[model samples]
Target: MQGTSYYIPAAAMAAALAFKVPSLVRAWRDPLLRAVCALLAMAGLVFFFAAPPTIAKVNRLTGVTNFSAPLVYALLSGFSASCLVLLVNWRGGPAERTRRISRRWIAGYGVHIVLLVVLFALGDTPVERLRDLDTYYANTPYIREMIVLYLTGVTVAGMTMNFLCWRWALQVHGWLRTGLLIIMLGYTFNTAYGAAKFAAVFARWAGKDWDALSTDLAPILASLGAQISAVGFCLPLVCQRLADTWHIWASYRQLGPLWRELDKIAPAHVRAVGNLWWSSAELSLTRRESDIHDGLLSLHPYFDHDVHARALAAAVAAGTDPEQAQAMADAAMVVSAVRARVADPEGKLLKSSDTAESATAEGTRDLVRISAVLREAPVAAAASGHAAMPESEVH
Candidate 1:
């Protein structure tokens, strides 16, 4: 179970780093992205080194028994520092204050790193007990202090992160807030991991054996916390991208009625850009909007002011809100114009009006609303009937 836990987070952090590499390369100057990449790298290192097989290999290679102990501690200290810096960069306050806070965290963690190295050097452990190092050296002088110091530093960092995430979660909204709350939960587990380890060490000092807390239980907590934290950090970015894609696809589908009507009247205006079946929603929507504008421009001569006025009155009589009624009226005018253009392509050109200008405007919210009205409004059917009549037959 411990092995599985370690490998899972290690794989996840590696995948996250791989996913962000392209963005990091494209925006190398983006401090927040750079911080995120660094955090993932450090987290990956922590999990990679925490595995017992890796620890034994490192101890064997370094010719110092249990060298992986200090190495893992140092990597974990660096990971904590990276998390703090990433948070600072992400929150984004005054530039000078951010730099100062980041510098202080780095310096403080640097001291922890130095302390870990010095204590590891001072301790004497001939046996390479990769998994049971803490229990083995529970009573040893320098080794005991070394374990306690690392635990203290980890606990402090975890507590600070939990507080920061919880406080910030209250101020944000949407996926960001949800992500922060998840991060806080992860950090809560991290703090528990530290507390468990500390309890084991304190038990040793009090002449009791609670070794399982450090040797077995704490590691599980660490692994669970690390994996959850990685997912939490990634959640907002992934969710936001999904949301944007959904909005684009929704807009494309909503604009279908308006796009199809205009295309029938002015098929020549449609520009073939790519395979319609394979095109992305954003690209398809952009092309559809461009084609709609061109088609509307071609039908400007068929725009009837009286048709628009009557549609507005009808929409109002139906108890639609003023803003929505306006959109319905605009949609009615567009449908009527398309029918008139098809009925008589050589009809006299109507002079440019505000309605024409607004109808043809690129990527406006009003256009989307009007497109929706065209899909379901009764005013559109009435306007189509008026447009279907010949000029001599209409009053």
Candidate 2:
């Protein structure tokens, strides 16, 4: 059961690392991405080797009674260093400063790892204790020092992360703030995990037995902390990508009415060929916008200024804001022009109109509003009906 708990989180971290691999390959120079990948990989390794089954397997494979002890400690130290390095890059600053700070953390943990190995080698531990190594060797010669050093390193890192994330969360908003808060919570769990382990080890030194803190309670806390921290790191990034995709697709869908109308009048050469199956939503929207502009250019000669003026006045009278009034006016003129073009199939009404050109020059939000007005505004529908009347009708 304990092995299953460790393995499950280890597998989850492996999955996350797999997802990040392609992006890291594409942007290998991205320090933040590199740090994220390293942190995830180190986290998985910590859980994998720390599992009792794996620890027993490694000890047997190496023909050493307790080799897994220093090994897991070194991995945890590396994991702690990884967390600090990731934090440095995630916060971001001047390039040189980030690199310098990251190097210092790596070097510091590198020394701790060497000391753990040296201490473990000097200590004499004939007995193998997979689940409660810290407590089992609490009073041993150099193994005791090894236990204190690794736990202290983890505790310091956890507390430092909690402080930094808490302070940063205060100044941020949206998903970023939410992610930071989650990270803080994760580190709080991690800090507590370190405290639990320390308590169990110190209890053994004081002629008491509290091995449950290390064997039973601490592992549960560490696993939960790691999994929660992984979510905290990934949530904002994944949510940001999803949010951007939603916005792009929403814009593309909103422009549909205008794009369809433009497609009807735009020449084959000017119109987008077909649905670009391979194009991204952003590119598809860009092409649709281009096609609408071309259609407006083709319809320029048939645009009626009088229709636009009357529609603008009616929209303002109806309490539409100035921006929306302009869009309504533009939509009325466009619908009127389409009707006028249909009525005069001979193309004899062709003449340049600065009014139409200016409407065509209007930006995307205006185009979106014009598209909405086409769908919902009575003024635009009325203009289309009026333009369809005979050229000699009471003029």
Candidate 3:
């Protein structure tokens, strides 16, 4: 408890530098996420520092000379900090799928962690067997008491967290919940070992000649349990984050400025003139506008060539009734084009109309929003006709 436990904080901080420092830069992008991650990192730093004193107290209570306390305090401190980051960023609104997943995870982990802490506060220990050292240290009573507390706490906590983790797994293909469960497992087995040790400690105190459990079993089980669980949870969370970040990056590349993209395709949108008897050339112009809008959509950062082809295919699939599909495809292109245009700053193109609504470029983004939508993908599927259904229908 005394020699080098306190010094480990320095090492912990050094290790945390990579994780905590860059979070400062990231915090600026999303104040909530960065703040949470950074704060947690700092908490992790504090955790290592607090370890020595806490462990020293345990050593005093157990009276075991070469005694060890599982690194639960350090882990819990860091994990709680991380939860702050994750909890703050939970999603909102009607499509509550992601938020629900996170909530389940949070609730599960929170319950288990609280129980674990309470058990520790009650002075749990893992020692099952007494050596001469146990007699000398007088570690049995308090340690045994803690074991009983921990077992009760973990039984409740682990089950709750595990269920939440299971729910999250069902919703998404990520391991955020998995990671949490793994860590919870650490508490589970650690508690089990402590429970076993509790029986041992109790038997020894009774002095009935029954073979009591020993302290040796508790620490080994706790350490291995914690390590495996923590790694199980952390590895997946890290991997999931990496994958999500990569997807965002890839999507950002093609989108460009949404306004600029819109402007590029703006002129192509057919003006909904009241008169139906327009000249053939006029009708052709409307068609040209539709084509340009569709082309502009291809410029969108997130748009892939496959989407365009699929829209075209839908038109064919619609058979003789292609209007819906074609119109939808065209409208989708217009919308994508508009988004790309808006995303661009340098183009700064404007939208104007020959009507009263087109007078000034105010709220420029809204100029043809409704009309453009009428000309594009999902919605226009009915307009594209059956021959082109395959290309126009959304996959």
Strongest candidate by lDDT: 2
Say which prediction, candidate 2 or candidate 3, comes out ahead on lDDT.
2
Error of model 1, residue 107, in angstroms? 2.5
| Alpha-carbon TM-score of each model against the true structure | 0.87, 0.87, 0.41
> Model 3, residue 23: what's the lDDT?
64
In candidate 1, where is summed lDDT lowest over 10 consecutive residues?
386-395
Residues 136-203, model 3: lDDT tens digits = 22344453444444344444444444454555556655466566556556656755654655555556
Tens digits of per-residue lDDT for model 1, 1-395: 45666777788889989999999999998889999999999999899889987887898898888889999999989999999999889889998899899999999999999998899889888888877788779789799889988888899999999888888988999999988888888888899999988888888889999989988899889887887887788899799999999999998888888887777765443434422888887888898788877777776656677776777787789898998987776777777777666656554444333344644332243767877777774656765654343554221
Question: How are the candidates ranked when ordered by lDDT, highest leading?
Answer: 2, 1, 3
Poorest 10 consecutive residues by lDDT, candidate 3: 358-367
Q: Which ranges of candidate 1 are over 4 A from the true structure? A: 1-5, 268-275, 317-319, 344-365, 386-395
Instruction: Mark the 10 consecutive residues where model 2 has the least summed lDDT.
Output: 386-395
What is residue 293's positional error in candidate 1, in angstroms? 2.3
Q: What residue pairs are clashing in model 2?
A: none
